[model samples]
Target: MAAAAATNVGNTWINIGIFAAFVAVTLIIVFSVSRQNKTAADFYAGGRNFTGAQNGTAIAGDYLSAASFLGIAGAIAVNGYDGFLYSIGFLVAWLVALLLVAELLRNTGKFTMADVLSFRLKQRPIRMAAALSTLAVVFFYLLAQMAGAGGLVALLLGITDKAGQGLVIAVVGGLMILYVLVGGMKGTTWVQIIKAALLILGAGVMTFWVLANFGFNLSAVMQEAVNMAGENGEAILEPGLQYGASAVSQLDFLSLALALVLGTAGLPHVLMRFYTVPSAKEARRSVVVAIWLIGIFYLFTLVLGYGAAALVGPETILAAPGGQNSAAPLLAFELGGEILLGIIAAVAFATILAVVAGLTITAATSFAHDIYASIIKKGQVAPDGEVRVARWTVVVIGIIAIIGGIFANGQNIAFLVALAFCVAAAANLPTIIYSLFWKRFNTSGALWSIYGGLISTIVLIIFSPVVSGKPADPVTGLSKSMVTDPSIDFHWFPLDNPGIVTIPLAFLLGIVGTFLSKERSHPEKYAEMEVRSLTGAGAEKAVAH
Candidate 1:
């Protein structure tokens, strides 16, 4: 027992040491890049200097959140094959971004998603609508990242106190703000690149360890997972394990798949990364590279998930502080002991930091460039002034994230991330597609799509089982309601994800509003927009630092 106690003590120190080293390296990158962010262009778009590979790596880092790394593994550990569905959906979503949106966005957009929307539409109203949708997506995404950060820190660091959790949230919030304020887009990009490399390396190591333990035989690992699953062993390799086998469950799964597939094309942070590349061609190339890297990473999650179930056991994982979020770390511990666990934990922390920083920058850019500069200043704000407002907006957004993280503690990180994707798909994707494709799509249609998608997603999620209803405990079959102390469950929305309904509704509203409006159609401007979007004519040039 004494020997076990000593081992625990040593493990804790190793974890702390690795985490501290990661933090220190991230800060160094931030400070080193701080000097180059003198212009609004540099602060917002990395001066368009990054190679496709670099930007692709950063995109991977930004997209692969803590939920992807830890939460997905945990979900698989608990739910088996159903958890792998997320991986397929998420990877397929990049094809949408690649074929439909990537090049057009890079060619026409300046800094934020609003820039792309406002190119041919009435500038002020379109920017306002785009900004609203951008903020809506960013808000929910930020909440998920912040919440995941707090939960992971509390769990991995062995902090049991509420105050300790709050501190962790604040520290993470502060660092995210610092990354944006000091390093700007360039700094954030480099940080993401580094973090992505570390994350892939760590996950690769874990995957290898999992395979080695099963004699490098995939079938052996599967059999082990089956054995560990007991009576439900066969079900572990089937689809109905997580979402159930009902009509509603099928619809829910479809909705979730829709969100994961369409959402990536619309997310503000992910779209904003296209602006960092030099040309539409580079933007296209970046998505290809990102697809490869992200695809490989999700494949690793599959192995890690099954490995955790077979090796770490679900009871041990569920009993951990962060539940499913602890599955990967716990698996690391079992396979490679404390040092590997610590490395994986630190990489996960870095992943969260990079993602939140990207989100903050996108949100801040929307506020400063779209609302503040385009609307309030009527596009007359000096570049310096715009950049200054962006920095301040980062601080404000950071504070909100910290508070939201505190309240969002103990919520399912993966569920929150899915909600964010649902909103993005419903609100942003339709508008983006119509703007780039349909010549008759007017300001009214843009507004309708953005507002319709945003409002519907929020309302549906609020009434969904994920938010208001009590979910049945997997082991005990007991309902644990999150709504009220008296357990008032009012979840009329059968689907946890709103994308299946909301996405089509958003597209329909855009089309309806466009034809109904008496506003003059902008075929001439659309002609120009099409040329620029297709040929990269008059695209924003990279500013020299």
Candidate 2:
């Protein structure tokens, strides 16, 4: 017992040491690049100097949050083949971004999503609408990251209770704020580049180790998972374990897929990355690069997920503090012992830090560039003042995230992230699609799409099973769930996700609102918007630092 205790102590210190090293390196990068971020352009879009490959790497880093690295693996560990559906949805989503949105966004927008929406429409109302939608999506996404950060810290660092989780969250929030305020986009982009490389490397190492354990035979790994899963082994290789086998379940699956596919194009932070490149061609190249990298990374997730089931055991994973979120880290411990586990844990922490920092910068940019500089100051704020407001905005956002994280400590990270995607798809996506493609899309249509989609998503989510209740226990009149309290039993919306209903409603309202309004259509402006969006004619140029 004493020997085992000593070993545990040593492992904890090793993990702490590795985590500190990652933090130190990240801080050094931030301090070094921060000096160059003197102007709003440098702070917001990295002075438009990033190559397609660098921006692609940064995009991959931002997209693969803690939920992707740990939660997806845990879901696979717990639910079998059904968890892999998320992998498919996430990877396919990038194709949508690449084909449809990337180049157009790069050509048309400068700093925020508002810039795109306000291009041919009325500036004030459209900017306000864009700002609201951006903040809404960022809020939910940030909440998920913070909650996941707290839970992962407590689980890996052996913090036993809520107080410890809160402290961990506070520390994470502080670090994220510092990264954004000091480094801006230039600093945040480099941090993301480094984190992305480490994440891919760590996941690749684990995959190779898992494959070697099974003699490099994929079938052997699946067979082992089946065998270890016991009675549920056969089901583990098939669908229905996670979403179930019913009509409603099928609809839910479609909704989730729709949100994951369309949502990527609408994410404000992801969209903002397009502006960091010099031209529409570079944006196109970046998405292609991102597709390959993210595709390969997600493929590795399949191996890691099933490997955890086969090697770590589902029962043991379920018993861990973060449940499915603990699967990848636990697999690391099982495969390579203390040292590998420590390194993997540090990588996971870095993943959370990089992602949260990206989100904060986007949110700050929306507040400063869209709301403060454009709307309130009417584009009159000095460059330095705009950057100052952005930094202060980061502080405010970080505090809100910390408080929200404390309240949302035990929530499922994957589910919260899914909700964010649903909201993004329902609200922001229709606005973007219409603004870019539809000539008759007026300010009223844009407002309706943004406000309609945003409000409807929030309302539907409130009534959805995710918030109100899960299916009741027939015998005990209670739910056996851990994520949400079953106190309010009025969950009339059959689906947990709000995408199916809200997405269509948003599009419908945008069209109907356009027809109902007497606003004049700008045919000449549409022609100009089209030329710029397609060919990058008169698009914003990169300024030298």
Candidate 3:
């Protein structure tokens, strides 16, 4: 597949410069945006001020990341029909967000999920639970991004030495923390806006070139994958034999697909991003933009997926610049050589930076807005102070995320992604949906939903086979600390993703708990939910442009 040894010096310098620019540009945006805030609304929600297009780009910035770029492509390289399943799951999950939660969320919550739940419930446990759940979701999502960014940045910079990647990620962690500190929501939104445009544009260019080379032929690539044996893994396109995965055995390809698609709407980090925008209508339009952008990006990914399998072979994924996750990055290099390769790497790193910033701020805001302002203060805090406290919380949360990434560096960390989706489904979505749509939903029901889902999902994953198998240790090459002698024979969980079990349990718990409680349906509240969510009643009249 290759004749020239890759010095990668050109790619490295270009990446460093781009990474530096993203940090500077992101901070400047955040700073300029931050200066506009006189109230907490401006700080946290941009004073309900984002335009439809700006919100749309922000949605793209929040949703896509290394997991989408690197993880999905690698899965395609390794797992056949099941790989495409992720795209279906991710794209469809947005429908659940768009059709069901969007307007209700806008109408019900002001700054946080707790705002919606507490709209009806007494405040004590509601704010605390919502904040905690949001934090947990943010922590895991942030860890995955930082871990990915540092790893890729190191490889792009030609510092593949283990210590080198760690240093690179630490720098990424610093940049993200500053992004939140200086820019707050305003700055973060702009960073997301620019990054989203670049990411989609870059992917579009690569896909165009690739398609031109292949006569726009999708079928040719799939056939090539079937025949090609990938790099280090010698991974053939055959379904049954991926690094010793079963004939989709206990874990059927269908369930794998289900976890990914169903998992999207449930992600707390993704959903919380909607709160930053002003209204339900804006949220709807934003989803349309995200779907359009994400859909196009994914279409391009299919090209990279097949291109890698066709040109590089699946085994070559292991040796590509960024490890197995390098499939997409390597595909860029394969298609356009060094200059295009540098641009792709920069865009890929921006994808990581922007996504993590969203995760960090979402977590910190939930903690401050929901937990501190709502629960602790009982709606009594000054808006300016609330914004200040949130800024500080961002610093604290950033430290926690950075620490987690360092501890977990050099590991596959792919499983962390699935775990995040599972948690989002279990903890955040159920409580959110019931509070908005179900009239019978009460405070007790909301609490139980959040906690019950959170506890069960986390407990299940810790003891699951991926963790239990004591799978390969990323650092020591020793067995995983969770278990010894990993095996498929004594499988505990039915499948890897807990969505099949946990998502349903989350819904059941919320509904059953609501029905059991005295139905405290405020007539006005129910009317309001219906108006805000289903129709555009109470909508602000648009100013003539």
Candidate 4:
């Protein structure tokens, strides 16, 4: 109750110490690796020297954000069957990335996702569109990670006031900027690798401990959760508890599923990781290795979620400082008290830091390489100038993230991440798919798809129930909508997620834009891109005009 009451001052300090130690150690690793960043290629893609397994672990680290650890566990603790769907959606997304996007993107792009898109299209406009979309997606993602950090630290340190939580978010953002500015891609990769290992290992330990309490009987664990839930116990095990109440809710779930499954292939950060590995083969292997590790970790979340339900209870979790995000930490406190909570808190912090660093670097690279270098400078900038611009962009992005995270502090991080997935699926996925597989996808079509999807998804989000007009939960007395002011209702969109409408609309816009354009089809360029994408020919060099 009361989010575990900070237990004792000694325990709180211990948690802070553990978290501080992790940041210090990682900072050292970042500085040591910073020396290797001697060129644009080195800073952007880690000199393209990472092996398959190494990149795979880092990819897993990058992919598994605060949403995966803090948010999903909390979601399952509260929503039961509906909550586990996030895990399934996130894990299944990898298949789409692997089968359709990973190897081809790796073989064709040099540093950023825009590289792949601009290969056979008009370089300046296509890169600018791609860069804008990448920045928007990264901004949404960074907000989720930052919000998670705020809630998590507030729960741990018992900082309930909004100002205190806002300060915590700022601190996390500052550290993220530091990591990107000092370490670049190589440093960030190492941090991810380290964080990913710790996260999985911590989750595995907690899962085993939770099951051990039930004599390793998963069914028994579920029964205990059911009994603890009282009147709502049976509903927890059923499908309709969260999403089955109305047709609109069911439609929302479908939209959510589409976003989760299709969004990974278009996520700028995840796509950027492919360029860090050496070749198309390793990029393929990276996805395979990531799948195995990620699958195992999600399995752990199932036990952890139910374990929290049985041990900590949903009321206690929701009452915590972080709301639903407090489930896993509260469970840790319930199981092993001070020590385990400290350890888990540190790992969760690491999760946020690694992910935000990855996102910040991606946004920075896109701005410097695609927008600044390709568009503003007409590709005339020196390597040092580009890297300098990237560092400055990191600072700007980090500051913006801190402010957004402050406003988003108490929201469920997983739900926030789903919104990001919706944006990615709508804004980037259509263009990416058409550019890779459709020979007639010209510059006009790419621009239409990117701008249309990006603008529509964002506009819909602003006018949806997610932004305003949703009533407070009858039981909790809290509104799920971002704008909690009941008098300021302006939402016109009925669904919380606009993916169902926006994703299809984006794809349709791509086709229509292509046909409407009188630009001649570049059959020769398309042929070269096809061969290069499939065979890894000329991949060592970035596509040049």
What are the RMSDs of all candidates, in order? Answer: 2.4, 2.5, 3.6, 2.4
Give the winner by lDDT: 1 or 4: 4
Ten-residue stretch with the least lDDT total in model 3? 1-10
Candidate no. 3 TM-score: 0.90
Off by over 4 Å in 1: 1-10, 471-481, 484-486
Tens-digit per-residue lDDT, 85-116, candidate 3: 57777887888888887667765666676776
Q: TM-score, each model?
A: 0.96, 0.96, 0.90, 0.96
Quantify how close model 2 is to the true structure by its C-alpha RMSD in Å: 2.5
Report the C-alpha displacement of residue 175, candidate 1, in angstroms: 1.4
lDDT of 2: 0.87
Which portions of model 3 miss their true places by more than 4 Å? 1-10, 230-256, 470-491, 518-521, 532-545
Model 2 agreement with the true structure over 1-545: per-residue lDDT tens digits:
32233224227678888988999998998899778888889999999999999999999999999998897788888888888989888889887788888899889889998998999999999999999999999998999998888778766787767998799889888988888888999889999999999999999999999999999997888899998899858898899987788899889998898888888888988999999999988898899888888989988888999999899788777767667788898889988988988999889889989999999999999999999999999999898999999989999999999999999887766667888898788888898989999999999998888999999888877777776678667866666443234575766788877888898999999999898899999999999999999988999898775
Q: Which scores higher on TM-score, 3 or 4?
A: 4
- Pairs of residues at least 3 apart in sequence or in different chains that clash in candidate 1: none
Clashes of each: 0, 0, 12, 0
The CA lDDT at 422 in model 2 is 83
Per-residue error for 332 in candidate 3, Å, reads 1.4
If candidate 4 were superposed on the true structure by all CA atoms, what would the RMSD be?
2.4
